[model samples]
Target: MTATIPAQTGGDLPAHNITISEFGAMKALAILSQSGKENAGVRVFIKSGGCSGYQYGMAIDDRELDGDTIVHDRGVKLLVDRMSLPLLRGSEVDFVENMMGGGFTVHNPNATSSCGCGHSFRTDGAQSPDGEGSGGCGSH
Candidate 1:
């Protein structure tokens, strides 16, 4: 199934749903088709460990586990597990290209801070003991 979400600007995201940009969706679709996983979905999740208290993860998955929230935007499917939902609510999945390289990224409204690599983040309610998360982004 597919869903059409209205356009939202910075800080104006839907309170309970995750959204994907046009560019992001296009790129994701291309990747999935190229990988022969056109029927699969991208799974987005948050896990303990990163430069921050929590790290972001994504994968091309064909199975939907129990308690998974499936979102379809612009022909691309995004799967988020129940345990990671609260922290990822209202986030945006985007793809960026730069001189360095290109990759998928999460624009999370719940994050208070993120690592330099943008793969890790800390939310208001998940602060570390020193008020900061340790370890380099390269380690993970």
Candidate 2:
């Protein structure tokens, strides 16, 4: 189920549904290169169960799961599984650095509301279409 996202920048990858900012790509590349893993990439996924019904997760993984959407930016691979693609469509992956601190940030167009922590969000009243609400981060 692997998909090659066309490169939006300088790479030869297929276009990706999600775009990674130059700063984000550089940051991710640095982390992956220093991770001591031979061929590691960044994995970004969404899980159902954040304060806003959905939470974003990221990590460095050496393996590519089936059905993963692989996008390359600034020599870094951004791996996103199929199920999480729709939730992240049209999103910009960015890395922000400031006096307060610095970290990865996802500016998702699909998120209707997000938690103060910026790691959880609700999708335009669709997170729970079955009339039942998903619990938040504290519930876990």
Clashes of each: 0, 7
Best by lDDT: 1
lDDT of 1 by residue, 73-121 (tens): 7778788888888988889899999999999999999999988999988
Task: Report the poorest 10 consecutive residues by lDDT, candidate 1.
Answer: 1-10
lDDT of 2 by residue, 15-57 (tens): 2467788889889888988999988988889877766777788
Task: Tell me how far the alpha carbon of residue 103 in candidate 2 is from the true structure, in angstroms, after superposition.
Answer: 1.3
All candidates: TM-score:
0.83, 0.82
TM-score: which candidate is best?
1
RMSD of each: 3.8, 3.5
The local distance difference test score of each candidate is 0.80, 0.79
lDDT of 2 at 86: 89
* Colliding pairs, model 2: 1-67, 5-14, 5-15, 6-13, 6-14, 6-15, 7-13
Mark the regions of model 2 whose C-alpha exceeds 4 Å error after superposition: 10-16, 126-140
